[model samples]
Target: MTDSLAIDAAETVDGRDQERGSDFARLSRRIVQAGLLERRHGYYALRLGLVAVCFVGGWAAFFAVGDSWYQLLVAIFLSLVFAQVALVAHDLAHRQVFRSRRSSEIAGLVAGNLSIGMSYGWWMDKHTRHHANPNHEDHDPDVAPDVLIWSVEQAAVSRGLSRFLGPRQAFLFFPLLTLEGFNLHVASFRALSRPSLRNRGLETALLVVHVAAYLAALFAVLSPGKAVVFLLLHQAIFGVYLGCTFAPNHKGMPMLRGAERLDFLRRQVLTSRNVSGGRVVDTVLGGLNYQIEHHLFPSMPMPNLRRAQPIVRAYCEELGIDYLESGLFSSYAQALRHLHEVGAPLRARGSVADPASSK
Candidate 1:
């Protein structure tokens, strides 16, 4: 009798979850209209404008300002604008927010190369793999043998270099993992057949020109020291935005066995979470803070993010899936703490099979 009752309770819970998922599915259909017809177009257009302004205005600010904190402000402006551009590039590469492949690829290259050196084909491959198998222990490229979640067997396996690097591996591993730019460059320059020949060569040329332009702008505007300051300051601050914004989309969240058990609605709620932001921040961040919706419906624009939540919440409730949402600072803090909890390979190396490796 008890066993039968337990099964019933579980089924009831799952039923409710499915109902909510169905609701999100319905909401998704209503929302994901084609093209840049909605506010999303406007929002992206505005962000693109801001990126242009920052590029032009940053230089103006550098020339205008003397030795003071004003330069820092300009740097922040450059970084923030450039970060949005990078996110757009990210979205384009993902095919999340664009209508056509050519347009997305073009946007991705223009933004990515200027903002961060990225190769189109290379980024596409790695990112596709990441989304395809987010948290699988073995198959997911994102999960190195070292980047374990929580399993005794997994921990035991984390011996040697994995054990040694377990604590700060993600940080150190970033440079190698995100080397698409270098990868593309080499593939274009080195490969005999040159598979990505035209695309890679064009981007490589653009990148060379971009560097040269920056150098010319540097000498024209200010001294060598100031130019270095400009690049370093913007790049580092942009790093902060990149690290936090991108990490939250998946890292602390539970991984899936596969997308099998996932419905469209559950996929978003279960696999993703949201961080509340003001209109300015929301717009600037590319609606990424409302990450759940963004992940579920990449075509939905940033302008609609504010309006999309209430509808999405309704669906989540019916399905019984948790719709994680919180203020930005709170989420950031939570992610940080979760980092150590998730990260504690406590010993010189926590045993892969050892539960004691983490609480």
Candidate 2:
């Protein structure tokens, strides 16, 4: 099934490229000349300012709660703030918020490492590869071996715990994401510990400060029980929030095998899905609802994604390429369904195995 799907997708791409080989590059240049690539300073200032105010407000509330059960509420608010700040860090990593690479790096470090206890260098290295090859089995870190088996090929190779979990992954996906916040912090620390990583000392120091300050503030303001609960709530919600925003982008989209070659536009569009919603959804998602547009132009500012959507969609339609967009709920459902489908064969095989063989 996986091989057949790969062949069909590859054939579609080859056919499309023959008809519209240079259209993507030409359209990209036109979009650039039309100022879609320009930064919106005012928009970014408003967003950054709002994030800062919410972050400070959340911390202030945490201190004021003072041993009350309201500390839990404050923790939830803090998670939202952290998610928003992380989105800003995402934009900075893409160099979408600033023209100067150094300025963007500074902003990313401050938001990712200092504020959110993640390593910016680590995230940038992984995310750049993801953007370049959105859903490539070998190249995209987002779909690499993790708690989820994104492709049937991956499911086929599963063993031990992964094999046990593979058949049930769709059912367990969201619950597993509750651990993602914790997982990301661990990954960041591990990345920083690599001997080959540059500026490792500074990244380590920033992570330490974030951890110490985050813990001290909770311990200082809440009872021991409340503090423990608060930490769990904060991290779990943070994980879910992050997963919700990102899972809709590429989870159900086409997966590229390592051997397939595709043109720039075909690769981006085919491997990306967009969520259809209004401003509230857009703001919550940090404009990531426009995943198709963002994947095509990674460095386009967040605000510009909405504007680029119609043009990109029309272009894809004219070229007879698939342009996928769905409501938030529908997108998630599709992703879950895709996971279930991928695991179906493994699940059937597992079901037929002898009970004595398990031992």
Candidate 3:
């Protein structure tokens, strides 16, 4: 790795004109030709079947708990099941599971809207833009003008709640993520209600089903206090589970200025970080542990990411580009450190400046 670093530095200084982007394209072609793009139908079937069991079993357990304090425990379990279902929806939106785009869309709607009360169309629009331009403050919805600032420019413009939270964001990051489940559901409903959005009726109907069924189940099985507690536990854990999985993928990595024109390969690899873990972590993150590979090949099947890791890593090493991989705990630490660093300007200046002026 040290030797490769030296080579990378030399290439940067010498202004190499070797068309490195083409090399990336060639490697991508090789990966496809090697059948890494092929769907593993049996694997997906098994995984989705297990997810179905969890969802059904979780709800069954909740109903069975019936006024018992143990319903809290059941609620936590249900949150995990919902998180797994969301992961499946993510894969479906990426078109990684089915050959037919229509099949993937249908699955995404069922898992996201009907099951999780999130709009598939809303998520798809945001996520597709994110993939196309990760970490860009302007183009990437994931990083765009959020309360948690990722760049000094964003911090400089912080106001209201964001202003109050700017200096304390690192400490608040995980706590804030606990609310993301509610935030996402609200965002989905808002998106579906937009007059310009197509198929709003379908998305709205699915979300209505999810909300009605979810509330009905809780009211049927538990007292008012227990129901409130159950909702809190379920949504909080669901949010944290999602945040823990996704925050590490790009939070501590490079932030792209919207103006820069980067090749597909450089853009993806540079902005993404891979999490290092075994089977349990992989299962929880749904192969998002291999974020670098997933970003490079967004449509690739999840089961194939582990197989492609070595190939991608070696190629990156040969190209002398950095390929970051860290344990789960370390990744979170890195993200927090970054959040702290970006917020420094806000702390030091003690005033919000115009973001345009920062530019």
Q: Please report the candidate that would top TM-score against the real structure.
A: 2
Stretches of model 1 off by over 4 angstroms after superposition? 1-27, 32-39, 63-73, 94-98, 137-156, 159-162, 168-198, 219-229, 257-264, 348-359
List runs of model 3 lying over 4 Å from the truth.
1-20, 351-359
lDDT of 2: 0.84
lDDT of 1 by residue, 1-359 (tens): 01110111123234544643545445545454322224356656766776777767866776788555567688788767666666777666645456666777777777766545445445555555655445555545655554333332354556666556556644453443333323434543343234643476776766666667766765666567876776666666676666556655555566555335555456546766687767866765666887776655554555666777776777678767798887766765555554445446444344554676465
**Comparison by TM-score, 2 against 3, better one:** 2
Poorest lDDT segment (10 consecutive residues) of candidate 3:
1-10
Where does model 2 exceed 4 Å of error?
1-21, 355-359
Estimate, for each residue in 247-357, the C-alpha lDDT of model 2 and write its tens digit. 999998899987897887899899999999899999999999999888777778888888888889888888999999999999999999998999897898877885658
* Total clashes for model 3: 0
Model 3 Cα lDDT, one tens digit per residue, 231-265:
99999999999999899999978888858877767
| TM-score order of candidates, top first | 2, 3, 1
